[model samples]
Target: MYGFEIEGGFTFYKFRDFDGSLSLSDDHLKWFWEKMGKAGQISVVFYDGSVESFEDFKKLAKLKDQHFFLGFKDGRPAGMFWLNGFTQRSCFVHLTIIPDFHGKAALQMGRGVLRHLLSVTDVSGSYILDCVKGLIPVMNSLACRMAQRSGFEKAGVIQKAVYLAAEDKSVDAAIFCAVRNNEVKVSE
Candidate 1:
């Protein structure tokens, strides 16, 4: 039932179930795969930054250092977030938001998700996170702007940091960094 209620009086994201558990399941993964499959582009990261086919997604999803989680809106898959490169205080974040989600609500949802993920504590009550990073493809200007609005600030751009399967070329990635702080507002 955890969701973001925007100005229009509608919820833009719903990641939790009635029992307060995040609705993470094979169904979510399947939904993500179908979306990526339809787009004809692979969204999973490669260890060597080489482009790989969809066949590798399931196998690579088990990579020890990385994990994926799904977010929802109105009981439908809204986005998938890949959290990787975890260290004591930081991790890399990658995202694939549903193309249909548009406008201010999408931006608000991004902000809320980032803030919630970074600020949340586990049952043990420990704070093992200090920062989260985004290496967004430079061509995706909307994502870059969304990151800025979501508490992530520009770090720098890395050349050929991401492989664009659709374009069949490597693209520059815009580095965005968000440190753990109380200033990340969950809503406007």
Candidate 2:
């Protein structure tokens, strides 16, 4: 039962004490989706399909075969992370925070979520995080730096085609992979 409270308890909490198979009802998922849609500050990067749709949420939720929900805050879905491709010894983390919760203070919350996720899982050998290129530049930088600081090395980048909002058609998306020190744990 590890958790941290911030802002004198105004409206943010980071929790990490549950297994990967955490569940949420349909109502909460829909509510958070609607809130994210309306919030101009929030932008979902992996938008190839109807990510905000309940079907997508259900898919991601049940993906606990190698993932888990970190927890929620202020009744809004805070963040969800998972480890994909277990045999590949890789874990991918996705974060969706309600716009109202995005700020300098939220960095700790994000770090806490990552730390908690990394701490709980065996990790097999290495972890891979696929995120939008330079998305939320400051935060992304922080996350990368944090991952490195936590003893993960930047393996390299894998470019994949994806649609860019600024562009009409799909383009190469840089996927960054960071690996822990042990090579036996992750495959090249």
Candidate 3:
């Protein structure tokens, strides 16, 4: 039961019962978008502003500085995790789990993906997560809490940094970051 205690003393366990795996190539794009669509039901308002049509998602997926991964549970598509701003020293981490697996399972998937990203990948320095300040109860707020629990510290706020399509405008964003070094004890 590989796990870590996050804020609120909640323990997120890594799912071992299923054949969980992560695909880093574009081969899983179709399956990845399918899960993204389902996860968007909860995540759209917080981050994406609106659900991306399959065609639109395809285009976004091809954008520069973005890397996508599809996580499988029992050999089935279960979640999506991606890194943005990868060309720079710091990158953005984003994740979503399908609606069916929202609680412990989702956290488990997130932990697994994050663990892989921080440990096995060369993309290191600091990882940033920006959340819209207004979408508190919906997205950014929860993410802020989670970031702290996961050992990320509040960096600062970037005014009008994010554009919410739903509002068709820009909004303030709070940034959180996790820096990796030999001294940082990142849970495995």
**Alpha-carbon lDDT, every model:** 0.64, 0.44, 0.51
TM-score of each: 0.72, 0.56, 0.63
lDDT of 3 at 155: 69
Top TM-score: which candidate number? 1
lDDT of 1 by residue, 72-181 (tens): 66666666666779888789887666665656756755776677567757579876577888888887787788888767888999999987765678889899988786
Global Cα RMSD, each model: 5.1, 7.5, 8.3
lDDT for model 3: 0.51
Point out where model 3 deviates above 4 Å.
1-27, 38-51, 121-139, 182-188
Q: How much lDDT does candidate 1 score?
A: 0.64
Q: In lDDT terms, which candidate is top? A: 1
- What's the number of clashes in each of the models? 0, 1, 0
Q: Which digits, one per residue and each the tens of the lDDT, describe model 2 over residues 1-188?
A: 43434332323222222454234455655665566667632334344443545577557645545343434665555544434545443455555555565553355455454444444433574333322112222224644454443334455443444554433445443343433333312211
Residue pairs whose backbone atoms clash in candidate 2 = 125-185
Off by over 4 Å in 2: 1-22, 40-43, 50-52, 63-70, 74-76, 121-154, 161-168, 177-188
